[model samples]
Target chain A: MIEPFNVYAARLLPSQELFAQGHRACQGCGPALALRYLLKALGPETIVANATGCMEIISSSWPETAWGVPWIHVAFENAAAVASGVEAGSKALRRKGRIPDKKPTVVAIAGDGGTFDIGLQALSGALERGHDFIYLCYDNEAYMNTGIQRSSGTPFGAATTTSPAGSKSFGQKTWKKDLAAIGVAHHIPYVATASIAYPFDFVEKVKKAAAVEGPALIHVFAPCPTGWRTPSNLTVRLARLAVQTGMFPLYEVENGKYHMSVDLPFLKPLDDYLKPQGRYRHLTKDVIAVLKKGIDQRYNEILEKCEANHE
Target chain B: MAKAAPQSLRKGIEVSISMAEAAMQANVDVVAAYPITPQTHIVEHLSELVADGRLDAEFVPVESEHSAMSACCGSSASGARTYTATSSQGLALMHEILYIASALRLPIVMAVANRALSGPISIWNDHGDIMAERDTGWIQVFVENGQEAYDMTFHAFRVAEDHGVLLPYMINFDGFILSHVIEPIVYWSQELVDQYIGLYEPMLRLDTKNPITMGPVGIPDIYLETRKAHDFVLRESKATIVKAWDEMEKLVGRRYRPIETYKTDGARILLLTMGGVSETAMTAVDALREAGLPVGLVRIRLWRPFPFEELYEAVKDCEVLGVVDRCLSTGGPGGPVASEIKGALYHKDKRPKVVEFIAGIGGRDVRVEDFQDMAKKTLSVADGAPLPPFELVGVRE
Candidate 1:
């Protein structure tokens, strides 16, 4: 059973909300909840380079902002690039005795559109430079802010506005881009995959990323209830189902070594994850088999990497 | 590092290398760049400086011109004195971020080694690149020679970072004409450079202690007003721009102006030009005067927040103002500068008839005789002879 909002607050997050109330985000926004947890772990001594997305639009509509820490929205892309500047600039200032405080942790926050596609070059550059920053990609599947257009991170067969199901075709013919694997290939100090369902796990990953000396990235599985056509309250539930069904594995890769943080040897059936979300409602039995096969292949790959790490 | 030579002591240095040294002297905090032709030498030397520990700056070698400008925006908003350099195609690639940099009020100083835009893909000198970015809301200035290129770079940082006029500035010089030329430059001491360009105090930056939001989305209710405010600031920055030039003059004894005139006093005909072409036209004007023609020269230095009053004052006394353009505006009445000259004088009670002549396009050499011929055509316009709105000088028929 899901905990009540009043009781969950004390357990899931701290009493002080760095991402304050009165934000324009829809109720039960998984990305907003993830943001709240990330901010709680990062604390107020963090400067965020926010890419333009749902979070940017909802938080900084105008004169009002929900962020308690210093934040900047550069463009739809280039959050990692902007965070690179922040990290480099602050380091120079701190070395020159200009910045008084222990250098503020720089973090870049963007939706999947910003991370996996349009912003890939900047992200790659920043990661290669090894700038001391944390980049968070809230994987909400599609371009939700611009009305649910399909992005490179949209899963195979997911029904997006641009990738709608038709009479003879399944939606979203392409698979999601493996952004985490790309980050790992950069040989960065830290890279992890987290889910909104597990707030403590995500928060711990955020804390570890902040403590790392070099660049780090967290690919967060933040579900979009509005875009996915699911009930608002099931956002967290869908995130949990995603990890449990082996569709989205919960893992961390530190210094090119993989560690399965939440390994479920006995994974639940894929329909348990797909049936709850309306995006997968159009899938026929044949399409479901294909999706399950793909998930099994990816899970096997992850299992091999984990075993290789142990060896 | 060695101490800089005094003003009397001249050092022959490559113009691009001098620009890199000028940025170093200004004590820049960050440099983000992607190299293109004619602009590569500048960033190449800057990379060497950072590598040698002569300059304590973060040199970010970005992947593309878009990322270059984007990173500069980031570092500038992060409270760092940021700089970048690019040429023709690179400038075109950075066009979008240019407006955003100005709108966000980041005081980033960039050097543009002006080169012609492509269809045929020429890597030569022209104003097509910077002219293409005319309305990007940056404080744009053109340089005539290596000395001006080095000096204006120092002035650009001061003008751009002024709290009253927090806007990005671009110092443009001809690609090979100035960037590749080695000239005698009086390098200013680091002390003098530091004194002139004081420590930057950003109006708003990323800080943990005092949280702030920058570059927020402006919706319909406030979009027009925000754009209005941005326009007003660019317009009102003229005073600060002049003030910055004035201080540079006092410090280095080198004067600059928006509209610089040569022998225009009591002149009946004026040949107006910009960038390195202005110096060439000045030589032609002197020869034409010796040949008993009342020909003068006017150089447009500031291209943005255009000095309408100063320009009118400079050319109003002349009978015909012949404008030389190195870039085409395409389907307009004339090239960009010539059109602007006509527009500036449109409301005046007594104004010179502006003659638009395009020349030296795509690095074609514009000889002194070319200027003489242009002057003759311009004088014909003053005599009420029929002429097209603009003419391409020395183009093959």
Candidate 2:
């Protein structure tokens, strides 16, 4: 069973929209919405270092920008490293009395490819160094900005342009890399997984990450209509279904302890989540069964962690 | 009114340590670097300075040279006086970000302990690293000795941070040749350095109160224009570069120039070089002069804007110019610097007969005799003796 949207918490969210509209994001872009909620949680006193990806391109076209707060986009693979510099620079300036003493939150934003693949070393270095910053990886599952190429974050049996579903092939060969678990392994103060469908919950996690004293990482599951071959308006529904089917779990790891943010007694059917997206249309019953088994095992492991944390 | 020489200390210090002390004197806000051979001592000493509270800055010991440059881009973008150091492979790793730093007009000062790039993997002194970055839009300068390297650190920061010239700067000194060798350096007091460099007041920065977007996507319509603007700023920055050097000379009484000539009066042959090799080349010119050969030496200090006028003025009267390059262009012209020199003098009416010599590669010692050999070969070529397109000096068959 899954809980409905909490009206009380939704009303408590900050009203200011830091991520302005009139941008070039695709219709119903889940990552755009996630960024909207993230900036709202972080508020105006934030500096964002974004990696080269869909969000960076869509929001930061030349001579125009949707960011109401200070933002910088450096390159494809060094957002965490750049943000570490920004945080350190800000701290140094404040300590040296160059800038005002107010502590502005520094945020690094990247795509799955930037976080899990090419940028892994920089991300690991930043987290290990414990820079007082937040790193948010918006996972749309593949390199959607580059026309849906396969990435390490692409799930098994899912068809992308590179991982086409065809005869003698089962689409992507490997399971999705558990980035949140990797973040937790860094022994950071905060690590969480979020979904765009749960706006209030996602905002809360961003707030918690902002309040943390050291490195915090939030792996956000964002659905891409263009990449997934789903209807433009079904981005939010797919994000919710992703969570309900245990495809992505909404949870947080605080200082090595796990707790489920949206605790569900039982997951909905995987068919409900996989059927709407054309990327998984070629999955046979055998492949579906294999994916189901993997999902259940991972979900149970998280449950075990959450239960162990209670003790 | 001339200011009295500020209280100073003369000490024999390693070039790398002196350079680090110069950065501390400049009061850099951030130092992000990775440890690479021949460049390690500079960053290690910087980290020691930060750890010991001698330098009040953020010392980021990044994992790789790529991240080191990337973090420098960030700190510099945030309006901090940023410094970093690297060599051969590390500079190669930073090749991608080097362009971005200049394109975004971030005034980052980087010290490159010049070392040879690898196939057999060398950690010794050469110009291969910085030569590969010749077109990266950074204001590149070559230093001959420890004192020059230390003084140029302040000059680089001042010129790079000039509001009209917000481009990155590279101070290139030969690794191990200059970096590891200890030389007597006259250090400036903190007050003098503070007055010279001043505070780095950035023209633009990431600030919440004044929200701005940096590194925006430049589409086809505007990308060319942005690149043109960057190029224009780099060309125009020569004025600020000269002005800064002149001001430093007024205070320190140590003069510098884009191109410095030695014993060139009434000379028919000239040897051209950059970095520490110029010192050796000068000795060879003295020997040639004693032997009744009208030979002279010309050293390039500023490399980026190319200093075509200064170079032409220095060598137009000479009959033969032996251009000594420390790195090869490999299969095409045999030498990068010699090729550029030929190109710079191509249209000149009274240019010398240029001879290219690739020497001192991968830390191979280029002695005074080697330079003399290059001059004699150049003189032969000038006298219509046939020779190869270019010669690689001191190479075993």
Candidate 3:
């Protein structure tokens, strides 16, 4: 197995961490790593409008804040709307010669619960208006802040507190929502899916999204060891397995054209991605086969779209 | 039949259009809202103004009222003069952000065209909508007619952006009664509006150069202080609200007060009213006066911060205080306004005998006769008659 730190560290962007250390995030937190990479890519010239989630709680607990850049946390479901305001307001002020500095790169950050579920309307509204901002949905799969509850982003056969496995029923009966595809359907300028395990690719995508004129979305696959009931050290390993298994593919859509960035000649087995997490321990061999088939079909669809783009 | 040209209409201007003109005159930077009945005309005209060269602002047609307010919060936090127009259900939908806006101290001005709440759903005029948000901590004021609506829009922008008060303002006008009606209104000159509103200087905003965290979680140890500070500022903002009104009076030569009293001197009966009903109640007072009854009117202009002192000063000398409420509190002592009046006068040494009358609910028209009848019932209550908690006026039974 290739070591991620040794391969990615030599070519890292910078050592200045805008999402600084000494915060209260859980041990081996994957979303924190994603936030760290994003902030480092955007730098301090950014203003973040964050929704209420695990990041908001752990970052700014009181007089203490993990963020070195400007940040605001509104309600649970309006980060995109709030970011729209920030972008529009800055434009108005600059047009009137009120502010001396250039408009900051406005970013809206939210958890999967805030993005794929409650915050979808606000996100859709902001995107349709063509606000110059980037909406980053850090997908941790479940509602980790309020405990392990099943969200719309939760994969099928995963057991959350709300979607517990029983004698007659599976854990989560629904498939994971295709949030990135939904974002692409809005006809936005750019929409991409990246994971924290691949920091260089994630940072490059963030830089690309920031350069886009219209609205852009970057859906990040942020693993949660606490929520997934996995070992603390296996956080990065699980994220890599997810991508290598083709369960969470890395792709980008620019101007409605699909382009695959990380294509594997052979995807690892789905059981390698699921067997480590205690949340999926109850899955039967039959259920695993069905899940593998679903993942393969989705991967094939992405490949077909990529092929069509070239044609 | 061909529709008549707008300029050829009998009335000078529609209230909704004039309110939008006032927003343009104030030089608002952003207008974001969803379309709802009665309030739709205001936002539509604003969008037109933005589309034309008249107003240089961004008009966001948000998906819902929740997003409308959320966008306004962002704009205001970015240190812009943000405004939005909404009505009953729209206001209710934005209820969650109403508190957050005030707590964050974002000076966003919102025009709430007051209307009835749903079920037995109706889009007609009523106060039930705003009454439900009585505790959202936003500075709420009720206006009587189109002239007051136009004037209060200017005043709300100034007062909300005041350095001493940095709070969101809600300028409420009755739905259909004031929002849809065409009435002759005095449009202040753009110069006058510019002088009155001056420039909005935000205390804290989203700036890359100077970053500050806003709306952080208030833990148990510090949450109490946050609430106390919010209450202190809201209660103390009475002075700033009065100062803003006084400045408007100075600028326009028209007197305005938190609680405006009419013919209360040497009178024993006082009819308390708010919103558009005050105009009709004034006629009731005139008719009662001709009949040799010493009846008067107490019109409440400010709905929040209670305006306890001004309200008490108006009703202290009256023998009977007839409070008319358009929204029911249901299971409370009386309607919301009457109950608030009762609570305001509870600790006073010299207080009038209060009688509660609930009228104009679900957009039921409150005529001069209804005000007259309400005063008469209150006089009987003052003359040693049994006082029920409240009476529902205009009910078929």
Candidate 4:
């Protein structure tokens, strides 16, 4: 059983709000809370290059913005590339004494479609070039901003608008793309998997990412209550269930070494995670067994990597 | 006419190299570019300069042209004087971000080596690449040769970064015709260029001390207003462009006008062109004038604002006007240039009979003879003779 929540640990978090309130985010928006935590960790000395997604659309309407820090929203798929430019441009200006010498942390924020699919090439390129920036992907599983379309990040047996549950077919036919592994494959200095459910763990990982010199990527499992067909208040609970089950593992890879942040001795039942969301309402007993087998296998792989590194 | 500068300043250099050198002289803060065919030398030379410590700038060799332009927006928004170069397919790849760069009002300058769009994959010179980007709200200008290419690089930055006119600029020189060719260019000293263009003071930038949001989502209630604001600034940028040209002339002793004429004195017919072909048309004009057919030549240096007044003033007295286009409109009215010219002169009472002649497609040569033929055909069309809506000159059926 998980330890009782420590109310005292909440005092350790930063009090300043870098991401402003009174924005147009949906009720119980997981991505919005994740962004707030992210900005709190990075603090005021940060510049953001945001991609076109739910966070960008909600926070940056004309004449009013939710960002209290320097932020830019370029096109959909090139946030990493744009962040590369910002980092390089800032460095050049600082060296030339054109701007002040206070170096700001450069960050790129994108959704799952911008991260896992359309933006993969630019992300790969920025990573390969070793640009000095943090790439944060708020993964809501599907293109939630565009009315629940299926993305590569959408897991198997989940029904989106495009991947509807039908008579002859299961929902999504493909498994979730391993974005963390893809980030690791780039051999960046820091790569990690984060979830909005654990605010302290998420904030800690972001702080660790910001301390690194070279490229770092943090794939955030941001739950979308609107698209997930879960209770609005259960967004954080669903996120907790994602980690409590093996559906989403919380881990970090620092310089080729793996360390699981939250290593559960026994995973919760897959049904407890899947049965709450309408996206997975069409799953059968055999299909749930198949998903559970895959999740256990992947979780074991992570454990083995952590053990090997501990040796 | 301005007095010539000392010959010691003139150097024989490739047009692409001169453009890169111009960027270095302008003290660019960042350059993000991807390698494409005719535009490769500009970025390659820039990389060498950065590596050699001759230029103090960040050189980002982005993965694609889309990223190149995207990165340019980032750098420019960060208050860095940014520049990039690309060709036909690369420009097409960067088509989407080009509009964003303008709408967000980032002063990024780009050099486009104008080449044909690919079907059979010809890497030759044409206006097809720049034509496709006409409505992208960039301040577009065409250069005639290496010297103008070098001069306009500074002009592009100067006008683009103006406080009142914060827009992206594109300088188009033909792909192989100008980009690969060598010419005697008068290189400006670094100090002189600094004195001419001055430092870039961005009206707004991404700064943590004074944080601001850029490229926000415009809802329908305010989207039209945003578009109108952009259009207003672009239309008003003509004065800034002309003033920059005048200042360059005062410093470098080379004069430029929106519409440059060649021997249009008392001529009844005029051949209008843009880019490198204008020089050849000048020769055709001299020949036609000697033969007593009353022909002259006019070249458009400024393309984006359309130069409606200058063009009408240049060709209003002429009886027949042959508008030479290097690219076709495919199914639309003749060529893109001709269509715009027709639209500009549509309701005028004393306008010339606008005859569109499509030539030099995919870098097929538009020689002096070809221009001469176009002039005679335009004159005949003016004399109550039947003609096609637009003539595809020098194309063998």
Best by lDDT: 2
Off by over 4 Å in 3: A1-11, B1-11
lDDT of 2 by residue, A112-225 (tens): 999999999999999999999999999999999999999999999999999999898889989999999899999999999999998888988999999999999999999999
Query: How much does each candidate deviate at the interface, measured as C-alpha RMSD after superposition?
Result: 0.9, 0.6, 0.9, 0.6
**Native contact fraction per model:** 0.67, 0.72, 0.72, 0.79
* Model 4 complex DockQ against the native: 0.87
Q: How much native contact recovery, as a fraction, does model 4 achieve?
A: 0.79
lDDT of model number 4: 0.91
TM-score of 2: 0.98
Q: Give the alpha carbon lDDT tens digit for every residue of B1-397 in model 3.
A: 1111222223478899999999998999988899854465889999999999799988888888998999999999999999999999889999999999999999899989888898788998889999999988889999998889988999999889998899899998999988988989877777677777888899888877788887777879888998898888999999999998888776676678999999898888899999999999999999999998888999999998789889988999998899999898878776889889988999988889888899998889999999999988888877889886788898998
Candidate 3's interface RMSD, please? 0.9
* Candidate 3 TM-score on chain B: 0.96
Sorted by lDDT (best first), the order is 2, 4, 3, 1
Error of 2 at B211 (Å): 0.8
Worst 10 residues of 1 chain B by lDDT: B1-10
- Interface RMSD, Å, model 1: 0.9
Residue pairs whose backbone atoms clash in candidate 1: none
- Tens digit of lDDT per residue, candidate 2, span B64-152? 89999999999998888999999999999999999999998999999998999998899988898888999999999999999999999
- Name the regions of candidate 2 deviating beyond 4 angstroms: A1-10, B1-6
Assess each model's interface with DockQ, reporting 2 decimals per model. 0.75, 0.84, 0.77, 0.87
B290-390: candidate 4 lDDT, tens digit per residue: 89887888899999877999999998999878899989998888899988888889899999888889999998988899988998888787777776588
What TM-scores result for chain A when each predicted structure is judged separately against the true chain A?
0.96, 0.97, 0.98, 0.97
Cα lDDT tens digits, model 1, B1-397, are 2234353357899999999999998888999998765465889999999999999999988877888988888899889999999999999989988988999999999999999999789899888898889999999999999999999988898889888889999999998988898999988877878888878888888888899988788989988998898889999998988988888777778899999999987688899999998888888888888888888999999999899999999999999999999899887776899889999999999998888888888888988889988988887777788765788877888
Worst ten in a row by lDDT for model 4 chain B: B1-10
